[model samples]
Target: MSTAAVVRYWLACDFHRERRIRAVLSSFHTAGGQLQPGIVDHLAGRRINQIKPSQPNKPYSAAEWERLAQACNTMIKSANTDHRRAVEASERGMESSDASLSEERLAWIIRSSGPLAIRSLMELFPTATVETHQLVVSLRRSLFPDQDVAFAYNLLFAIRTGIVPDGIDALLTGDVTRTGPSSILLSYMKGRTGKESLVLSRAAVRVLDQWLEHSALLRGHAGDQGSQLWLGTNQRTKEGGRTIFTTPRTQYRRRVWAQRAGLIDDDGGRLQIHGGRVRATFHHLKDRSAWTGRTTIDPNHSAKVEADHYLSSHTPAQKDAIEGIIEDAQTDIRRKAAPPLVTNERDAAKFAQQFPNLVQEAELDLPAVQKLLDAEQDVFVAACASPMKSPYAPVGKLCPARPWVCLLCPLAVFTARHLPNLLGLKEYFSAQAAQLPLPQFMGVFGPYAARLDEEILPRFSTWEIAAAAGNHQTLPLTLEEQGCY
Candidate 1:
């Protein structure tokens, strides 16, 4: 639809509650037809009943949601005023038949002088929320107190589930059922494409029950055993009679709330809360559940659509969360693998200098003279003096191989001074291996541990082994306590 038509539809529909002429007329306005019945009929002669696809909505940030909720409070305050209620009542034709609820009335106002002027204002801002004690004591309640509970629930449900305004109108009493823990069944699905049943969260179920109770108290009927869960009174209809409350009015009030909240974006896309909320819900699910490769919030969506579009558009935080999961998995694998070995002082010094971040040094001395040493809890092991490049070291970078891989490499050299670190490495790997997946445990830890136990330990002297055992019991614990764990 053209932008003008979209703007006109909300303006015209917001004022009238007629189901017959206004319903078709509202469709014409949204579909870009002239306000005149003859012109609208001419434009939609053949394709009168065709449904148009909705525009994609952008998701709101956490700040935007908070602002929207706050705005709802502001609107409630303004809605209670004599002037505001008069305007709202006139718009709904609750005033005397002689009273004017036309552009002329709005023209006298400051912000909106006419229909076009109000439309322009709305094009810039959209309103969207609720109050404590489960009610909004505003002009709406003053004018239509019977519908207050139902109206509040409509906004609450939409904010929570991202359901379209029209979808909410389709909801029935039978749709709500307690199926299981943390699950409330929603049976009256929105459209043909909607899920047969939706399992609502426990929190949602609690609110739903409250709304039902409020409805029963006000209307003097049990909402739990009725045809419609949402029942509200209205002042105007095409027939100039009372009508059932619907989404169009709810939508208009929400926009007013949003505009007051100052949550509307510059582009005016969020003026319509449904699409924006739906997008936000989708993004939240993607961030939380994408790693399992089964992130589906709205059950109506196909897997292909979810994977192709939603998963590919992860926010920066979502990307970081996914990477964190992968890192955890990789760490688990390395823990099960074998521990590295330093058989002599030369190798120990070389490994220490090559991987300074991994090895804690007591002093910064030249590697050529090999004076730097790895400090234990209260002792220092003299550095190894190996001459050749580490066999497992990566090109132009520190070693990427796991510690256990260092034990199996032929280039490895070690001595008594290296005993403490070597024992700690073995202990760390043995503890991690148990937590890793079986494939990673077998592939990395089993073979490396065997090599460290067999070939490397035999080369160490009795005194050196004793020192390593002592360092293993104390040195690693010291590093952990110092926040280097």
Candidate 2:
């Protein structure tokens, strides 16, 4: 057996493991000097597809997402209020001396001096009353949260920006720059995509500003340690009891915050708040079809990744709407692929015999088909069998389709009489192709021009085409059509 066959047999039931093993072997092959063909070479054209898990980490439901957002917002708001009160009390002549210890006094001390003043306050009043010590500890906990208050700010920012967790964690003070009055340019590093930047929305800017204010006191005390945009306190230290200036790292602390906030998922269990899930929820709730007339949601990501990871995962209603759009596109493709119903003869003598399926499909009898061939139902270019029953317009109204639209319309019939107009349309298409860009010309007139040149005109005899070409003139056209030339 080949190397690929042997590897496949060895890991037949564990495709995920097989993919990892293959990746390792591929890396080894590259590191080595390619001494032999090896396993990676044998598995080159084949894909070891892993089975998707039945219950993947799907985007959170709307209710769960809203709860998460509200919880984060509440925590941030409370921190902001506490920070504001502390600043205000400090300005009102509250002192950190041993005169009398109160919450406002402790707040003033922490605000004036750094968080380190809490230790000094305890030392200054060793035999102080129980209420004084309690007040000092409570004030410290409120101002510099030991549980990493940065989590709330970081989660809220991620929820709004849809940035990956690594990008958020790697952010520094210098990464945030004010680009406009209401917007900020945030630069961060992503492991996979390297350095990236985004112009934050007004809402995101507000959240970031609140966080900066909330952590401003600690940052001033921290100096070099506060460079990392997020700062909290580490209460687990045995020496100083609670050390200030920390970053959000552990998931356990975030879970504690979630529990404190009383957040619950759809299953009524404790909400598992992770940065990845938060980012996914942000994208899931965003309008994927909305064009901002600028850049994409995440320009660093490829279209395949965007579709596979985010766009493909949607609620039932979204899936239904997307399916409807896909069905319409498929129907249009099938209609365009159908050959144009053009005939050289001017009468319906052989219309039924030549195109019996079309005749039956349109439910056209001999007299109705004859009327189409005799130009009685003539439009600008072709004779429409039933103008009132056109698919391009309302059922009871005339088709307001463009002249070239008849080339692909199922209800249209072409005969020798339309040759002069058809030749004129071909010239019009040529002029359009010259003026418009390649992609635009291909998108707008490619199908119609292709049908006319390759299908409709080819059915006519060379002598008949020559005769029609001689009679071809500047045909009467609408303002829209005349403007194109």
Candidate 3:
């Protein structure tokens, strides 16, 4: 694993606890020495495999291995006793509210407390699927331990569907009111919900929320990061380029519901939760994971870069803001290609002569335009709109208005491809959106979007497992990340 992969590796697991562990390690150890089995033993108890020669056909490096070590450190620490107890406590609290306790509950428990929760829940269902009678009995015994509470649930759907935080059971529970999660209401409390909190169903949102809270990010009805959802730079010229920063589907959904749930109106743009872009999220996660590919791909370098650079230090909202930028960067680029640029000096002169009066009135604008063009023949009217600059450079730097950045940006690629599908970003966005009903779209995309946050992207990433944040020692990123040294 490269530095970035190692960071993402820890993120793929218990990113929350791994954050603290990373801090500990960064503050304590400073160098990349040989594989330190003693440290691995002390942290995760997993012995390191001896370094082996790479096959002639295969190439690997020490830096990658060090990254893997950092990620492993996070996983190891998450399983540490302190983290376990914290997760267990969270599971118990969730159980207090979780209605279905058989498989659904079992899923939640196991995912949260890991093998321990599984072992405990397994005792309740000694004979596989628990009928209502068995479920009731198990529930009574499990909930009260000493006495039985008669809580009756409806007839079963699928026992396997419930329990795991991001599992189908959790999803089913989320669809209905009884198991519908109120969300892991968090406000800097740092609830340690654990990975077991992740289930496939609607409960996945709650699980993801709790997972974030566990990472020490404050969550509630509303909060803002006081940051712009864009990443772009202004060149020496008057124009500045921008890359839109978009919130993940999970965070976006949480935001929408947060308002309905009476949490907060506008997190003042700092925090936003929209539940409509899970597919895009999956693609991004896959892209990052593909880099590490440990035992699989090249050991994802991009993910590790993200983990190293923007994994934890920034507020959850800030991190999301950055990820949003990255997500946008990977998005498909689309725009009205400039009308054939003013190809020649003769055409430019003719256009000037035709608009001679308008030109005189807008001298300031003309100078800016002339400055942008290397010569009079350089400009051309494209798309029946204003004359556009060369396509080679990002549109933002070419155009001055901040909103214009969307017209020509690599980050906007995904948005460009999907905007037609989404009523929000489509042409005549407000008008088209007004003509269409939203419930159905929200239903399918809503949950998916909720599933794409850092807490869930791992499902699509290289890890072949759910990913988390905060799992590396060094701030992993290229020199350009503003927050790091």
Top candidate by TM-score: 2
List, residue by residue over 1-485, the lDDT tens digit for candidate 2.
36756565646657677677667767876787352455655557575566676653568889998898898888777877766765776655363454555556667765666665455657765766888877766666666655446888888888889998888987899999997778899999988989999999888999898888788777887877788888887654455565664557467877788889898988889988877777777777686536545544588876677778887789999999999999978978887788888776655758779888778877889998888877789987888878888778778897888888999988778888889889998988998999999999999999899999999999988887898885665666778766864
On residues 332-369, what C-alpha lDDT tens digit does candidate 3 reach at each position?
22222211122223233554564454345334254443
Per-model TM values vs. the true structure: 0.33, 0.51, 0.14
The candidate, 1 or 2, that scores higher on TM-score is 2
Ranking by lDDT: 2, 1, 3
Q: lDDT by residue for model 1 over 58-163, one digit each (tens)?
A: 6666566555545543443443343344445445443334433233232223112211222232333233122211112223233332333345456556555655
Candidate 3 differs from the real structure by a C-alpha RMSD in angstroms, to one decimal, of 31.1
Q: Which prediction has more favorable TM-score, 2 or 3?
A: 2
Order of all candidates by TM-score, from best down to worst?
2, 1, 3
Worst 10 residues of 3 by lDDT: 147-156
| Model 2 misplaced regions, further than 4 Å | 1-57, 93-98, 116-121, 240-242, 288-485
User: What is the Cα-based TM-score of model 3?
Assistant: 0.14
